[model samples]
Target: MINVFQPSLGEAEAAAVAEVFASNWTGRGPRTAAFEAEFAAHLGVPAEQLLFTNSCTSGLFLAVELLELGPGDEVVLPSVSFVAAANAVAAAGARPVFCDSDERTLNPTVAHVEAALTDRTRAVLVLHYGGRPGDIAGIAALCRERGLTLVEDAACAVASAVGETACGTFGDLASWSFDSMKTLVTGDGGALYVRDPELARRARQLAYYGLETASSLDAAGHSDRWWEPRVGGFGRRIVGNDVTAAIGSVQLRRLPDFVARRRELTELYDRLLAGVAGVRTPPTLPAGHRDSYYFYWVQLDPAIRDGVAADLLAADIYTTFRYPALHRVPIYGAGELTLPGAEAAADRTLLLPLHQGLTDAQAHTVVEALAGAVAGRAGAAPAGE
Candidate 1:
């Protein structure tokens, strides 16, 4: 069976973990700190700006929590995004206002965000869906003009960039993922990058039990009080441990190669599927931007999408829909808000296998299966009465 997603871990990762096991210091220790530094360096950002977490969800939650939002405050986000973006806003006691995506790109534009803005709106969460960078520069300008915070959900965008600048650096705060299926697999972990020093300090304390670490203690005072622990704020055990960090450091070294392989596979898929009837490939990215290709998505006629997915499953080739429209979800409430683009995308988009481990033959097989499925569905269509 061909998997839609898989992590590329090998002897290097195993050796890293083995070393961690041998060290006997596997909690939030030197290895974790080293990973944070290396990750920031990869993005060309300062080490002080990054805070490692247990998952991207936790990083996002910390971003919202730092804003100190409450029931009266609101955060606007696209309905087509992963539910975690909405969940983070809700977790911070802020209402998540749903917005529409641009049908071509499957990401929200500045106009869609503007339309959702209310006086109570405090922030805008922008997700780089499928590792494709959205209009982040434009969105950042709008956020600045409106006095709103910008939090980037860069979970799928490890090395993705708009022009020469990276995606995560544009927003005021950003969250990155390194879960089992993400571009950088740390087994299960994430990181938060914040522009504000106070926010970074708060996030670091929050990751632990609100207690100052030994380094922080030295900075505060070196007197007799140095031996005593200080609890400065409310917190939780959300920090990523050294064991996972060790693995992540090794993965980090190989990210450029991983991204390159995925891009090559995506190009093959595009070449194979071009001009196939009733099939719409993902929009070509604008010049100066690059996608990490976390999932190579294509849109099929909504009527036959389900059948095509089933056909692929029967062929032992796995596929999936990226996400459902968040506003239509029950827990987010059955709001009257209408997002035509989001609804349209939810009904038609399908994710094909595009991971580091996928070979040229596997990609060809996937495209062939899809073409056959589309043809079968076309032939079975009812004639006009």
Candidate 2:
């Protein structure tokens, strides 16, 4: 069976993990600090601006929490994104205002976001879906003019540049993921990056049970030899352990290679499926935005989409349904959203296997199966009566 997603981890990762195990300090110590420093440097930001967390979901939630948004406030986001985007806003005690995406790109347009904004809107969460930049500059401009904070959920996109600038560097704050299936994986890890010093300080404090590490201790009037947290924030530390950080550091070093390999596979798919029947490949971004292929999605013409997924499944190729429009989900436990474009993509978007492990042969096999599925379905339709 050909799997849709497989992480590329081998002796190098094992060696790093072994080293961490050998060391006695395995909790948010030297290794974690090192990983943070390296990750920040990769983003071209100062080291102090980044904070690591257990998952991208946690980073998103923490970012919203620090913003002090609550019940009366709202955060605007596209319904086409992973549910984590919606959940994070809800976790912050704020509402998520769902918007539509341009059908071709699968990302929320600036106009769509502006339409969703209301007096209560406090922030906008933009996702770099499938490793493509989602109009970062335009969205940033809109957010600035509207007095709204921009929080980038760049979990699927890392090291992707937009007009010579990286995606993660555009927003006021951003959350990144290192899930096993992502372009850069650490089994499970995440980070938060902030451009403001005060916010960075507060985020650092929040991550570690609101304790002031040595830095905060030095500021206090310590007459005693031993130092402690100046003010009680919660002694429970949210800091990640060293074992995962060590693994993450190694993954960080190999990220460029991973991106390159995935791009190679995507270009191959583009060549094969360029004008295939009943298929629409994910659209290309403007010239300034580059892609990092975390997922390679295609749209099936409705006439044959239903059979497309089952056919791929029968052929032992794994496929996924990215997301239904958030407003349409029963998470509201209610009826439906009024978004037409998002609803259309939600029903038709199909993900093709595109991971670092995918070979030239595997890419061809999936494309062949897809072509057959679409043709078979189109051929089987009932004749006009």
Candidate 3:
């Protein structure tokens, strides 16, 4: 079966892994440090500005913690995002305030987030959906106007851009995922980018369990040596590891090519299925915004989604619904939250076969199958058909 998500790891990745295996140091050390340096450089930031973590989730959790967000604090984010976005806030002892998104962009707009802000609102978490960058400048302006911190959840947005600025660099602190399914696969890894030196230092502290790294809490003002572990700070780093970074560096080198391939695939899908009935492809972003096209999401008319999905499955063409609405998930509990657009997207959005390795033929096959399935459903007569 053509899988919905596949990590396009080949000789390059295997070679990287083999190198790590050959080396005795598999913990978070040289390789991890190098990866962080390379990633920060890629983002046009100083090496000292980045922190590597186990997962984007951990990076986000660390961001929330560094900001001292707590039970009385409210963090605003789009309800349509990955549940991890909300969970990070909840994990930080902050309330997750859900907001509506722009239907056209499928992104949380600055106006919507601004409207959701309460007196308790502490930070704004913005996610770049489907690898398309959100309106970072507008959101940043809103955050500045309101004196709120901005945390970017850029798990799907590696290499994505809005105008000239990269998606992950717009917010005060941004988290990126290098999980197997993302554009950049690192086994299971993530990174954090910070614009502020002090916050960056604090984030490193939190990621390493509040350990007084030489760069962080060195009261002696020595730059080379770390102070002895203090009793109060969170002790021991849990997430950052070397093996993941070893794999990550290789993936990072290929990121530009992977992003280009996905965009090419998306263009091919748009062309192949342009006028197909009941198949609504999301619009391309304005030229200034470079969308990485991680998942080519389609909005199927409610009537045919299930049948079409089943047909694709039978044809050995895999597909997926990226996520269900946060409130709809049993774990989050069904609150009194009313988000119509998010609820509709949860019901109708379908992720077609999209990855760096998908060929033109495979993309066309899925589109053709989707059209056929929708047509077959339309022709069905009542329940007896």
The model with the greatest lDDT is 1
TM-score of 2: 0.94
How many times do residue backbones clash in model 2? Answer: 1
> Residue by residue across 78-177, what tens digits does model 2's lDDT show?
8888889898888767888888888877888899999999999999998888878978889999999998899999898877768877787888999888
Two-way TM-score contest, 2 vs 3, winner: 2
**Colliding pairs, model 1:** none
Against the unseen true structure, what C-alpha lDDT does each candidate score?
0.89, 0.83, 0.82
lDDT of 1 by residue, 1-385 (tens): 8999899999999999999999987888889999999999987788988988999999888888889988989999999889899998887778999999987678899999999999999999999989999888899999999999999999999999888788898878999999998989999999999988878888888878788763454655556566566888788889899999999999999999999999999888889999988889988889899888898898987878999999999999999987788999978864787899999999989999989999999998999999999899877866640
TM-scores across all candidates? 0.96, 0.94, 0.92
Mark the 10 consecutive residues where model 3 has the least summed lDDT: 223-232
Better of 1 and 2 by TM-score: 1
Candidate 1: where are CA atoms >4 Å away? 214-229, 383-385
